[model samples]
Target: MSGLRERKKERTRQALSDIAVALFLEKGFDAVSVAEVAAAAEVSKPTLFRYFPAKEDLVLHRFADHEDEPARVVAAAREAGAVPLDALRDHVLAGLERRDPVTGLNDDPRVLAFLRLLYGTPALVARMHAYQGRSEELLADALGGADPLAARLAAAQVVAVLRVLAEENVRRITAGERVEEVLPGAVAATRRAFAGLGEGLSSFC
Candidate 1:
């Protein structure tokens, strides 16, 4: 029964987010109101608030699934007796090959529009920083070691490198470059970025 209830809640949350994003994309983020999103989703403002406490969350929920991805990758690497940094680099390279939106290598029109909306909105950008901070914390926890501070610093660097790489990919794609054209450079950049990290973090984790 509890599982069923959770499933229903997830569906409701996804539905509301879908409705809110469509409305925001059509009318612009600042132009739309929480009240309007709630109405469009056919729920009262209170109910929408129950699911997403902030208006920004209506859009940012799209990233909720990926918040722990870096941490998970590190954990999996440890379990498999692989270097954490290498695992993360491979994971990102694979994402680029598949044009994962999180890697910002996707050129889908809808994804491009969504990226524009996310980066163009100051509030959304600020909130995204908060999300990155959380990712850093999670990765730090996963990279646990005797020197806690070192783990945290390493995590911060890793998260920042990944974010910058993704941003660059998005920039090129949005500037009208084809994903295939950007693939080699993107792959090379990722390797260089991770190689830099390996200089200090290879043995730390």
Candidate 2:
């Protein structure tokens, strides 16, 4: 019974998000109302708020599953007795191979359209920055009980690399490059970026 309730709730949440995105894309984010989204999804406004507390969340909730991905990778690496940097690198490589949506290498038309919506909308962009800030905090915590400043610095660099890579992938795809054509360069850039992070700033003046 509990499991069935959870599945039903998941369906409701997904339906709200799907309908919200469709409407936002059809009109514009600012032009659409939360009440309209609730109406389209056949849920009460309160029910929609139960799942997404803010208007931005209607679209950004898609990223909720990945909010702590980097932190999870660091924790898993620690458990495996491996370096977190290498773990993150391998994760990016695997994601690239799979053309993961978060990696921005996915060529699906809908995904492209969604990315377009996210980048084009200032409110969504601001909200995404806030989400990344939270992600940084999670990653810093996962970096272990080190100097707090050091962990924060490392997390900042790591997250910056990821943001740059993802943005570049989106840019290339939106510019009409196929995923297959962009894959090689993406892999190479990610490897170099991670290598720089793993090596640290010892050689710098």
Candidate 3:
């Protein structure tokens, strides 16, 4: 029953997010209101708030699944007796190979639309910084070393590198470059970014 309830709740949450995103895309993010989204999803405003505390969350929830991905990659690498930086590098390369939206290497129209929506919204952009901060903290914990400051600094650098790499990919794609045309450059940039990190953090964590 507990599991069933959680699944039902997840469905409701997804439904609300879907409705909210459709409405936002149709109109605009700032033009849409939380109350309107609640009405469209057929849920009470309070209930919608229960699932997403803020209006920005309706869109940002799309990223919730990957919020801890970096940390998970590090943890899994440690368990497999692999270098965390190498594992992270491979993980990102795999994402690019598969055109993952998180990697900003996907050219799917739906994904492009969503990225436009996310990047064009000031509120969403501001909220994303909070997400990045959390990712760095989780990665720092995963690094787990005697010098907490070093772990935190390393995590920050890693997170910033990944973020910048993804942003560059997005910039090229949004500026009319095809994903195929950008693939080689994106992969090379990712390698260079990780190589820079490896110089200092190869043995880290």
CA lDDT, every model vs. true structure: 0.93, 0.89, 0.92
- Model 3 lDDT-worst window of ten: 196-205
lDDT of 3 at 172: 91
Cα-based lDDT at residue 113, candidate 2:
92
Per-residue C-alpha lDDT of model 3 across residues 9-61, encoded as one tens digit per residue: 98988888999999999999999999999988888999999999999999988
- Candidate with the greatest lDDT versus the true structure: 1
Candidate rank order under lDDT:
1, 3, 2
**Candidate 1 per-residue lDDT over residues 1-205, each given as its tens digit:** 9999999999999999999999989999999999999888889999999999999988899999999999999999999999899999999999998889999998999999999898889999899889999999999999999988999999999999999999999899999999999999999999999999999886665
Tens digits of per-residue lDDT for model 2 on 1-205?
Answer: 9999999988888888999999999999999999999999888999889999999999998998888999999899888888788888999999999989899898899899999999889999899988999999999899856378888888888889998999999999989999999999999999999888878822210
Q: State TM-scores per candidate.
A: 0.98, 0.93, 0.98
Model 3 error, position 176 (Å): 0.9
- Which residue pairs in model 1 clash with each other? none
Model 2, stretches more than 4 Å misplaced?
1-4, 201-205
Instruction: Indicate whether candidate 1 or candidate 2 has the larger TM-score.
Output: 1
lDDT of 3 at 178: 99
Which residue pairs overlap in candidate 3's backbone? none
Evaluated at residue 56, the lDDT of candidate 3 is 94
TM-score: model 1 vs. ground truth: 0.98
